[model samples]
Target: MDLQSIKDPSFLKKMNNEELEALSADVRKFLVEKLSITGGHIGPNLGVVELTIALHKEFNSPKDKILWDVGHQSYVHKILTGRAGEFDTLKKFKGLCGFPKMAESEHDVWETGHSSTSLSGAMGMAAARDLKKENNYVLPVIGDGALTGGMALEALNHIGSAKTDMIVILNDNEMSIAPNVGALHTVLGRLRTAGKYNWVKDELEYLLKRIPAVGGKVAATAERIKDSLKYLLVSGIFFEELGFTYLGPVDGHNYEELFENFRYAKKTKGPVLLHVITKKGKGYTPAETDKIGTWHGTGPYKVETGAFVKTPASAPAWSSLVSETVRRLAREDERIVAITPAMPVGSKLEGFASEFPERMYDVGIAEQHAATFAAGMATQNMKPFLAIYSTFLQRAYDQVVHDICRQNLNVFIGIDRAGLVGADGETHQGVFDIAFMRHIPNMVLMMPKDENEGQHMVNTALKYDDGPIAMRFPRGNGWGVPMDEDLKQIPIGTWDVLKEGTDAVILTFGTTIPMALEAAEILQKQGYSIKVVNARFIKPLDEKMLHELFSAKLPVLTIEEAVLQGGFGSYVLEFAHDHGYQNIIDRMGIPDHFIEHGSVERLLEEIGMTTEDTVAKLKSITPKKQKRA
Candidate 1:
């Protein structure tokens, strides 16, 4: 069977269970081989092969909507819908998206990259379908881990209560990014191992009826006894209570089980929750054995050896630097506590968790809860370090504004991956945090120029006891700079002058600092004296320095690896305007549009944010002749 020749899932209608199983095997092989070169969510995709096949075989896609919750597991869906040939360029620039894209095919009804959004999206689509008097099934395949999300639970409440005709596929794999936690995980754990619920219930009812009701008497006592025992054994009781027709503990790998449950779900009226048990990384040995979620996604690997492609690190990752520094600081400060929303692995907080198990918290994909939970700790005079990715923190903006900032609580937010986060595309980009965080009152926002400065800033943020503060750090390794032997606190709201010049000033920080330095050196070689300033504090503009630049009437250029509007550049411009300094200024950054998936360097080049562009912008802004007296 040529996998690449697959045009659509329509071909699945004629195929029997044996053929579908074969197809699943073929799909797994294709994914394992293809993704070895171009890395992706191989573990998740491999888990869903049979389930996806059975879905297409049973239901009509494009017409019958199948919404993948996070979309990382939609690779099998993509291949069945004629995207197998595109695997070579998957997640590359101008290539197949890593997540479901509505633009890619009509089959992709609901586009999603974030978790727990599918049910809500499904409800909207269901409502629209009813309004238009159209009949079709809306199945939202959500993970057991996603059910912990506040939004998903809300949607479940609404959809169940409303008696909407839809199928909520509960794909229970015991993992999501990392191993799931909380009460929901416990419930699902019971559900996974709980044997023959109906048979046990029948046996219990039979025995209870036969046994005398010991003084209480009759069928009412017997019924009560049956009810009590049923809940303890029945996993579907949770879904049934929520008004969904509880269907399975179906084996996701078996086409027969998947097809049988999916059929039952389709015929059933109202909301049907088909609890399908899946094994994450079912086909491959290495991924199957992955315990720490290292194989959730990857950057290329060896197919034969299952080893990751080589990239000898020159420096510790930015996440490691920030998290390790916090762990070091925590040893001395008993008030310090660490929290992440299901990103202990991603944030490199494993060491912290290992050392301070009681002090560390893995909140499990609840950003809003994590934010307020950290705030609650802050109220107790406890230093809560809320480590969250910049993109995920957006979901908790209200908590950040209302609970954290309004109360003037001292919470240190480690804004991880705080720039254009490449391959994960626009959904995962950490570009908007500065724009959103700076405008909030009593918020101190900053980014460090290098690994040394990053660790110091981490120290600075933790020590600061006034209101809320955040330190944004980029993805991947640092510049291999020597770390200071002792942790030191940088002065709040101060900027560092990297190079001093009288003609023109280049204001930049974090990832763009090197670009600014390179651009300035190039300009100096071309007989122009240029000044480079590390504008570390984003919210508090270097006003005194700005005043000096204004008095000198030096042409200024601001560079940032974020959106130009409402960004660091805008902050500088705002300061200039407030003081009424009519200075010639130019801002270089990502424009008002969303940047797509690509290598960071390529994305920077595409947005004209490279050293060459910086030099060009500098040349255009500065006066031709430098008369240095």
Candidate 2:
């Protein structure tokens, strides 16, 4: 049968083991070729081909609810569910999303982009099933790295205590982006090597059966001995104690082993955990050889040579500049330390980690703990730089407010990817940081227009000892601006005027600054001179400049690459209302609705945040008298 003709996985139930293996091969080939042009989470998807096929054959999806944690590995699942024809538009604007979208198909029972959510989601489904008197199995496939998250641990406790009828597939690939860490990883490591436990259990059972004509006392003693031996030899004792029936150390790639364990798990009454071991990037050679996770997710690459298609930007990436600046300061400041929630490579902290291994902490997928951990360090007068992506930082809002902001600590937060992150889509876009962070008391938030200002902001954040300070930087390469030889501190509550004019004032910062400047130049040619100011400090607005602009009665336009509500522009409007300025004010930013997956340019255009959109907005608001002149 043709691979694309597969509408559902029901056909897999009729296929033999040999035929299943052939299908797995075809799927792997399809993934490699498709992803070669449109890049994605190739390594993860490639690794799970056989395991995904096995699961489909054994269980009915949509009805059974096979929830994939983090959803990046669901490419194979999408293929089996008749979405293979949509591969060309994967992660594109208005096209197929990278992660599992409930709107995409019925088989995608739950949507996920953030880690460690599947277990909790599965527990909810299990409880709902019982309440409705339904008997369909509730299964969640969670990775080993995601298992280290506190939420996953909490869910494990609850599900075990409830003794729910569900299946938790512990997909052990020994990675979540990078290599797994923490004590949970250690426990899993022990379980992986304890394959001899089954042999020991069988041998002990045979010995117990050999006690011929044993009476009640002898039989009881034998039973007690057998139980003790089982605990001593088996590595699943931890899970067993947690009220779950533990199964496997099964080979995820082998159909027979996977099907057998999955079938057994389906029959188990209480919660059952099936430990399956599979290799990430199982089929492709380059991805298979990856040790540090270069192939986890990537852009276009050559299939034969395994070489990435390079665009070769002239400037450094925003993450590298910020991390390197922190590394330089750490050389002089002994109290300086860095923390990341399992993103050493993505956060560009490898240099810092290499120089100060003891000072760097990768907290495994625990964002909430990482935030408070930084707060705890601040309590001791240590300067902790928490480097985290904006989207992931949402998970630590409570810690940020209750622990950091309330206590007024000096934790320097480096908010990486703080704007429209392309390709990864709406789930990963860093657009909400401004609106979320601005409301928190004692939290000083700002962004930079270029690498030079970015480095200065880094220095400013680390040096500031008053309260919690954060500097947001957009994803991708910095604007190749000239840098200062020596670092300097930027004053709090200050704004810099990039261009001077009298017709109107444009307040904007970060990625949108270039657009503002372009618009100003266009307006300049048409005799409508405009002023462009970098409103970098988001929380503590530049009261002095704002007052001057209002007093002069210059029509003002505030723009940002973030959501409109409670954002920088909204704050400006609030300030105008409170101060009784009666100034002509207009705001431009992302709308109330969620932005979808697309290129940064495409998303900006969709939201009317482009250079052309900026010019059109300025033209609409310009005075009739000024236009005639």
Candidate 3:
């Protein structure tokens, strides 16, 4: 099949089964070639090729609803849905998105990037269909890894009780980013090994029906026995008990088998779960064996050698600093334990995991559970350091407030990537932790100005043991600063005046500190003496120094790589208002609207967070001397 000729899913549907298989092979080859240069989600997209093909072939997409969980695996779906030509521009600024965007196509029912949301979205679509008296299938292709989430479980319980006519495709790749962890994964493992019992039950029903009058009652009795047999035969009894008719342990890679299973599910009345087994990196050897999930989503690489291109590993990332600091501290303090919600690699806790295996816990993408679990561990005299991304921590805000802060539990939250994470765009930006966490009672929210400060804060949080403490750091490398072997604890809730000037002051935190300092240097050359203060602690706000800004009667600028509303800048304004100062306050940070994809440098410039933008704004506020006429 020629690549140019097979432009859309409708083309593949017109082809016979054998021709379709050829087309899939061609498509996989195209993906491997294009992805090697473009750098996108290769492994997940590779794994879902056959499933996507079968789904598009089986259902009329625009008319029938199909929602993908997490949306990382939607690359294959995107290709079939007529977005294949855009693969060259994947994840680039103003190009194709990495995840499903509703504006991209009518076929894409939901815009998703986070995990465990598809089930609930599917239920809404299903309910809408029932309301309109429309006969259309609502299918949500949810990965087995996502089923561990509390929301997914809740949706499952509701779907079971309501008995909605919906088809759920459980794409079991036996992994999610990392080797899946927890009891839910264990249950699925047992079920996968046991295979589907649908055939055996059907055979028993056929044999009993042949027995005549007694057979009618016997079939009814078999139904009850089958309900009982579920617990005996499989561990997926939890899903079945919820009222869903269990369908398959079908081969997701097998196009014919997947199509048949999908057909069977479509014919069924109540909720049906079609469990299809697949490999994470299907058809690609390197991805198939990738255990760390590095190949899951990445930059341009060599497909032949599976060698990622040597994009100079910039300065040591802040995540690495957190990981190293935690590992060093854990070695000294036996009470310290590390926890993350399925992001050990991304959080840079691989070393900590190796050093303190028992003390380390990967809570399997359950942020709410991880926060509560950390609180529970803290209560038992164990200091649990939860390493979570700020964006994901939003999912567990209530737990952070209720279980940790309100109860005054000693849980150290290592908030990694606590600012604008470029390229992955809005859904992934970690820019709200400061605002959300600041107001919580007993919560100490602090972001470091440098890697050394980050390390010091980690030590401070561990030592304090007062209540819930959070330390946020940016996504990438710290500004080139020397490291010291000896650990020092900076006094908590204190701000550092890096440079003193008379004209005005620049107050900032985390990633924006370097930008603030650079802008100060540029302004200093223009004869405008500017002060730079590293406002490390966002919650406490360094009351004395903050009050001094008003006391000095200087014009002020607050910079942060976060939204302005209810953020660091807002806090500065509130402080000024309370102090009754009329000093001009200028806010320079991310705007209220969602930012788009680009390189970090490009994004900073685009959003006017760079030194040039700050200098321009500062010049606007700087008063020109009155004419000497």
Instruction: Quote each prediction's TM-score.
Output: 0.95, 0.96, 0.96
Cα-based lDDT at residue 374, candidate 2: 99
**Against the true structure, whose lDDT is highest?**
2
* Local lDDT at 578 for model 1: 89
Query: Candidate 3, residues 1-629: lDDT per residue as tens digits?
Result: 55544455776567667877887788789888898998888899889988888898989887888899999999888877778788888877778888888888888889888999999999999999999999899999999878888999999988989999999989998888877898989888888988675556656667767877855668679877766766666766767778887877888888888877888787778999888898887888888889888888877889898898765754688899888888999898999999999998888989999988998899997999999999999999998999999999999999999999999999999888788887787788888887788879898889888887778888898988788899988887887687777888878789999989888888888777777889888888777778999999998889988777788788999998888888888999998898788999999888879877767788887788788998887877766433232
lDDT of 1 by residue, 251-328 (tens): 889887787777766777899888899989988999989888889998899988899996999999999999999999
Task: Identify the runs in model 2 with alpha carbons over 4 angstroms from their true place.
Answer: 196-227, 626-629
| Candidate 1 global CA lDDT score | 0.90
Model 2 over residues 147-184: C-alpha lDDT tens digits?
99999989999999999999999999999999988988
Task: Report how far off residue 17 is in candidate 3 (Å).
Answer: 2.2
Model 1: residues with Cα > 4 Å off, grouped in runs: 196-236, 626-629
**lDDT of each candidate versus the true structure:** 0.90, 0.91, 0.85
**Winner of 1 and 2 under TM-score:** 2
State how far residue 281 of model 1 sits from its true place (Å).
Answer: 0.8
